[model samples]
Target chain A: MINKLRMGAAGAVFAAALAGTPAFAADNADATATAEILESIDVTLVSGTSLDFGAMVVTGAGTVSLDASTGNLDCSDADIVCSGATDIAEFSVDTASDGRTLQINLPSSVNLLRAGGTAGNAADELVLDGFNSDAAYDAVNDEYTLVYDASGTNEFAVAGDLTFDGSEGPGVYNGTFNVSVEYN
Target chain B: MIRLAASRLSCFLACLAAAGTFGIALPVSAQGDLLVAPTRVILDGRRGTEVILSNIGSEEATYRIGIELRRMTSEGQLVEVSREEANELEQAAMRMVRYAPRRITLPPGQPQAVRLSARPAVELPDGEYRVHMSFRAIPKPQPVEEQAEQAQGIKIKLIPIYGVTIPVIIRHGRLQATVALSDPGIVTGEKQKWFQLTMQREGESSTYGEIRVMKRGNSEPVYMVRGVAIYPEVGERRVTLPLSSEQAAALKGPVRIEYREMPEAGGALIAALETAIG
Candidate 1:
């Protein structure tokens, strides 16, 4: 019985050693495997205010321009009517991923047409030309450095001029343009 | 429609020169202040999802929302694409998406939603489609100065527009992707040492997962990265992750490298490999 026990113990030890050799060898080769991970994200941006260019009256063959900085209006000599209640376009951003920098993209210009009407002539159209924005951006370089504040918010403003031809018809003019935001 | 001359903002500089203190405030280009949520979106037979845009700046802003195309390079950089360059799968993806109110104007401290829905065609081939939604700031116009400058031949407008973009993805029917880690290496260059990982993919569709490196006997990973994407553009991609000196030193022996889905989605183990480094 004693001899049998000793032989069994030797056999067990040898078996354990052999089993360990493969794991050590496996470590020598590069390890490789695959993993499947579902992807999802919860991001949302809310609009709190709308861009108000204010109300304006078109005079004769002159232009009515709005200052982006002061939100003031400048009507040319051909102007017949004018109102000075223009407001700069404003936006505020909120996100769960606070402190991440974002970039804003805006069109260089936009056109305003007489409301519910097509281009009749020069008098039927006006242009919002040359935009000066508060957001730090370089149209040439296409770069931005925008970040949310500690409270998970980032705000910006857009100001542009509204130009009318010498004889813009008397009516409300509306137009639509594009703005894009991205993580820098 | 008003025939507006789309002029750049640089024309305003000339105005400042001519009209000294003309009561017109100049454009004060400050750092961009905008917020967007869920940097990425994945829609798979789910209801419509909403992306929120908020203006965090002190002033009100108008953001024009539009869908743009971007293709991921092997190095994980997104390169913009034009409609003419879109592939068949990419084109199909665009047709399946429907978003409302392309333009949103907001005041300071206000937020707006761009609702998005995926309308896949019946019997559509199983694959992944994506589009990048962008929110850009529309600069206020400087009319009087621009026209005056145009008359004077000083047309140098510098309207700096800034915004953000996020990936909106849709998956249709029986799509599978396999992700693996290989070529584990430690590279030191430019006065920095980084742990480099080679992520490999197989099968159809794309894989978006996180990479984690943990030493033996440690429950937590020493280094981890989320939002690692292995798009269908490449079968293999090499990503370099910066590591502190201490973390690099701790990585001298055997370490377990794991690639898993986002933890929010249960972080299931897709593939794992053992890498021994010195």
Candidate 2:
């Protein structure tokens, strides 16, 4: 009987503990400051120019690689017509923090799927290699140090080589990739 | 040249003064490419709140702001979700959150306010709803020269986009939560030791607070983690916090682990547990 009474008492205590305290009484959980400190950062990448490998008329199957450093293209030995502008992809970063050092995150390579060229409109296989940052500070891995100027602006461009299959489709091929920036 | 409002100018000066006085380069403006204030929002069905977003960049930029779903992992990291992955509760939560100025274009040093409001259905159940509002930077069009340089053969384009998100929560009537700490253990990894604690949450709402571990006879806590959230999605979660070498060594004795609601969040004693460690 005594043990039973003790168990009952413990159960009551447990119930009270579970009830604990009324938390939302005043709707006073105003964690605005902490949240602001943790979040609210924004980094924008504005594209100045797309990485244009120019026009290439392929006579035979071969690879065309673009030098990330100079945006120059090296066509395979196959007879090809190179025309138009061969320019690197231009990007500028705008941050709220002026003159702050940031780490830019870019993928080393991305597969740009050709639109409507694949079976059932699936992504066609096109690989972009050698993601490069134009900043004097070399990228440690795929991340580079972005130094904003006094006006809170930093411009960096990424260049890559495009690998194409022998029989390539002639359409407006488009694909999207993600680049992120954060305070190091 | 951009003009700052008198109040904003004062805030800027004050921030600079504070940074100088503290001697620590507080990540005021230098940390983020974008500046947003009022990081989290809590709506009680009164009026809508405005989240201020500013473009601190040098050139013109466009940003897309939208509400996204996120689920908190046991490790306290938020995982973003796609629409198809959202459950019924998450879908309902998304339906209630309303925000405007979905898209904005601003020049350097320009600020805009995105108004957010929660309009819950009258018959909706009493619970806490949450959505992560994302502000993603959109890339402008390629320059004329680059556009004209389009190649005839297989070409590839890779554009990088960046952004941030904050949680907006809405609480309806008469919600409660019960928090209990269990299965406290010490985990030793290759390079670090961590204190793992499992919090069991039972109720309609979530619990937000600080987790503190104090050694007996010591006034100061040996381990403390802030912004710990026990969201309503899970009935229980295991929270693993890395322990400093000193803290891990000190934990070889009797300790008290408590999950207390943040003072800003109401200063309530959510849960407490005492254990002996070797």
Query: Which candidate has the highest lDDT of all?
Result: 2
CA RMSD for every model?
A: 21.5, 14.4
Question: Candidate 2 lDDT, tens digit per residue, A25-118?
Answer: 2233222111122123444334345667766665555566766557677875565556667876555544333323444555566766554456
Error of 2 at A10 (Å): 48
- Residue-by-residue lDDT tens digits, candidate 2, B137-248: 6777655554444445644554555555667888988889999998888877544566778899999888877777889767577776665677888788876655557878
Model 1 misplaced stretches (Cα beyond 4 Å): A1-184, B1-32, B143-158, B244-247
DockQ of 1: 0.04
* Docking category of candidate 2: incorrect
DockQ of all predictions against the true structure, Cα-based: 0.04, 0.12
**Interface CA RMSD of each prediction in angstroms:** 27.3, 17.3
Candidate 1, TM-score vs. the true structure?
A: 0.54
Candidate 1, A48-104: lDDT as tens digits: 323455455544455555554455666545553554345556555434332233455
lDDT measured at residue B107 in model 2 versus the true structure, 0 to 100:
66
Error of 2 at B190 (Å): 5.6
